[model samples]
Target: MADYPVTQGTHGPIYHICPGLRVNLNDDGNWELMLRTTDKRKRSSFGKGEEAFKKAIKAGELLALKLGLLQVEHDKERLLSEVAAEWLNLNRQRWSGTTHERYSQVVRDYINPKLGFLPLSRINRAKVREALTETAKIRAAKSVELVHATLSGIFNEAIDLGYTNENPSAGLLKKILPPKRKRNLTKPDPFSLKDRDLMLEAAYKHLPGSYPLILETIAFTGMRLGECLAMRREHLDLTNNQYFICESIRRDVIGSPKTGDRLIDLPEYLTKKLGAHITRMREEALAGAAFTDFLFPGIQQNAVRLMLKRACYAAKLRSRSPHDLRHTYASSLLMAHYSPVYVQKQLGHHSISMTCDVYGHWIPGEGKKNLDETLAGQPVSRRPALEVVDKKIPLVAASGTKSGTIY
Candidate 1:
């Protein structure tokens, strides 16, 4: 046994066991590392041994450096929830309102419940994997992915702030989480042109005031339901037979359009109809009707959905969602021999591959019909260019008689 420099503590005398480290043996006979920096002290037990004391000193110094305690006092034992809140505050301005809200929900529902209490330093890859495994049990794979992403974002921000060394959620997803299954490649079931026409006609006959026109606009221009409901008179360009899709409304919060701004061309008939609807809206507004900037004035997404549901029922048609109207528009354009690039722009898809991925099968030459047509044309000759003939040749037998053989 060697004498070590010792300091007095409330429990007993603590040993100055290593450089920038101290140790105290507790009543339970456990050797605890008493970490002393310039501004604060922390205690951690790594069991009773000279070896354990040395290892604890090394680990504590590394953590202290990571927490910036070497240069200044820092809250090294921050909970995951605290880091998440800081992350949200720093990034709230960068993300759209919907995106921020979605991320907030994921943190509150998934990450906070499982890992919020854990200290930032204690949250390693295994801890994150456990959280993800638990989340996967009850949530969809996509939800689990979001949870993973939220945690990664928080830890990454923590890393940049020197609060932690690594993002535990990084790369663990592919290893521990189940691979996301491929989405079905089948073309979305949208209303046929005839069915769309029938639905529109029935809507006009059954629905009250401007609802049919709203449905018609969605079908004519591949506008999302939110974008349609967010439209104001300023968005319409009747003379050009086009409208600008620049903003959207969700839960009464106005924000940028999902895929950014785009211009959508409308048919002359649709343009005329929209013009007439606007004229009537102005008259109604002047006549003391409820005024709103929305083209569909005072209608929200759910109201529009209900209107569409009733219209479909009245049309004696299969029930279709409001989104199905957008689908109908894209499918019809693709069926009319329109190029995927054109369709992508018209629908405001972020990428051509996205448009092709969803409606590629609807493209005339990209479906089963194309395969049938390709095989129906002809079979090219694949015969060999050379021919050989069989001839008889003389061969000697073991019995010394000549035998005839084919060569």
Candidate 2:
């Protein structure tokens, strides 16, 4: 290695590893990392901090490659595309078909085209970041997230198999990607009470048999659309006005509901409505319509979504989706001062934090009502203290003096 020059600065020494490559320590007493390709034509970055030093090390390696100081790849390294495919195929049994398919699509469309050609050892955080940044430019935040996850998954597999030692895509989404504009945070997506009513009315008139009932069930209970579709007559308890929710439909497949199954409470009105609907289903079954054990036969998620849109249009209400009805149910509960725990149970959420994260904005950030007014509290009731008396006989006290009284 050639000897690199060093210089003293106002605060500390500047270590010049080579031309256009320096670790600077200045008045702030922190390391400043600056790196550029030879000839100083391509300056990559200038940053100050311990993290900058780490990034600089990686950047400097890249600069070294450009300067002909390092080889790009060795025979031992495998191309990232090949590694990714191997990683995905190996996990096929570990993931659901839909999950595996989604990840495969992400890798094919977003990840492989960009970083797949590089050797696994040569891939770094900057390359992953650039790919994700490019994805964000053209894709929605959600799609970007999927692309990021696919990359991270591949890199993780690489580490476990000893193909690479670092995970370049780790923490890249949260730390590097710009904050997504959360529409739910700005304004709750749940429909208004009037909007809900209008939509139900429109669905009843314009939609086919049991379509309105399906929407009503979602509106009254925070049941997911998938769960609603998967429901069977046995799942209902009309007497208790509760629905036993366990299974859900997804991607035209019956499966367990998200977060597992829990019974959902239904209002008495909805229970009666379900009772009549079931009777109607029985009547249709006798008349020759195909007998479907499901509560809403032939209605799927996409169909429910379309139903909501049509209802919204007919009612002249703001458009929404089936899942948005779930949101509406939660918002109604929050507005009624239902505790987070209750809402969490009703929605079958995994955690209280998740419940709050999605619907916290609907809740009052500050105390909105005085305790007296809200609770109808008054001075606590009290009973009178019991009276006590004591008597003592003095008959023999000082016997001579008490003789007359004693007798």
Candidate 3:
């Protein structure tokens, strides 16, 4: 084993070299030196393992330092657009099609147009703020904010990959004016007791069997439009009264959820309705000498939309989109006084906060009532104080012992 002398540094021991060979002076007061003939390729960390060990360790350390310096310089020259493309490609497999499509759209429509040609070093906080505000002028404030987030996330990836030291978009806050909140979009839906009956009657009179069942299931269960459309015979467990939502049908593609990775449980009423629909579907299939696996097969989503429109129109109700039925479900749950946590899980929301954000308003004067109720539940002590009254005697009966004031 060849031994290499170890010299003490500020924190640890580093290899000591002879003064026979020297390079340019480093940041330290002493001269930066190197061994001229050492094979940088054969370098290793061991300084005392064999005859070649000392020379190898020295070569490796020098080569590694040179590479690190080169990387730092390269990072300084890297552009934001280049880093962003690399980041998106790295994460593409983990993202869903809709999500990836949306991100690509943002990059093409917003990010590239403004920041594509600019180097990462040149993109400062002020430039980002300007770009964000410009977008807000063209689009809705929320949309601008979303683009800001998308761009920030891309830059953040660059930081993580060692292409940048800091994320320039990290601390920039969105400059949004207060927005006016709107009433529930589902309020016009004919899902009320009377309206639903009328709508059902109209649907049965005009539409075929499968259509009515499809619409009713969406309204009843608050399942997403795609989830209801994608159901197969295998997905439903009629005997157990539950269905597993492993896949959804969106625009002809059998896919997963937008939020992704969730299994929703169906209520008993929905389970029975689904069972009945499956039975009716089987009867139709057998009578027509045809077999199908889909619960709502042989219909496009656009056709379903049209049917819903016609039903709402014939029932003398305002037209509401299918997604609104999901909102109606959420509102109904809150109005029925169901726990937010239960509803959140049923809806496959990532968090209770998200459920609250969407359905919090429908909770019906709950905030103040909750506060009052909490105060009322606490015990408090009560106290009473004694009181005295004074009466004056009449002056006319001053001579009388009972009426006279004593001197």
Q: By TM-score, rank the candidates, best first.
A: 1, 2, 3
Which residue pairs collide in model 1, if any? none
- Relative to the true structure, candidate 3 reaches a TM of 0.55
Residue 363, candidate 1: C-alpha displacement in angstroms: 3.6
Q: What does the lDDT come to for candidate 2? A: 0.76
Per-residue lDDT tens digits for candidate 1, residues 1-407, read: 21346778776667654456666777776667666767767878788777676555455545545554433332447878889999998999999986887788888888876677556865677778878988877876677778888998998999999988988888887875545555222235689888899999999999987788889989888899888888888888989999999988877777888889999888999899888888887898899987666787567788888988898898889888888888888888888778889999999998999988787776655545545446756433443446666666768899989876757
1-407 in candidate 3: lDDT tens per residue? Answer: 11235666553344443222222223342333344444332212332323334344334334533444323333457766677788779888997655666677788789876776456765787777767867867777567767878888888898888777877776564344343363122232325556766776788778875788788787777777887888888878877766777676755666687666555667788788778777877887789947678888767778888898899898888777877677777778777788889888777788999989877876667655456446866533332335544656355554655555532
Give candidate 3's root-mean-square deviation (CA, Å): 18.5
Model 2, position 197, has a per-residue lDDT of 94
For each candidate, what is the lDDT? 0.78, 0.76, 0.66
TM-score of each: 0.64, 0.63, 0.55
By lDDT rank, best first, the candidates go: 1, 2, 3
Which parts of model 1 are misplaced by more than 4 Å?
A: 1-76, 117-127, 130-140, 175-187, 201-211, 306-319, 364-407
Q: What lDDT is reached at residue 327 by model 3?
A: 73
lDDT score, candidate 1, position 173:
77
Two-way lDDT contest, 1 vs 2, winner? 1
Q: What stretches of model 2 exceed 4 Å from their correct place?
A: 1-89, 92-127, 138-142, 162-165, 179-187, 363-367, 371-407
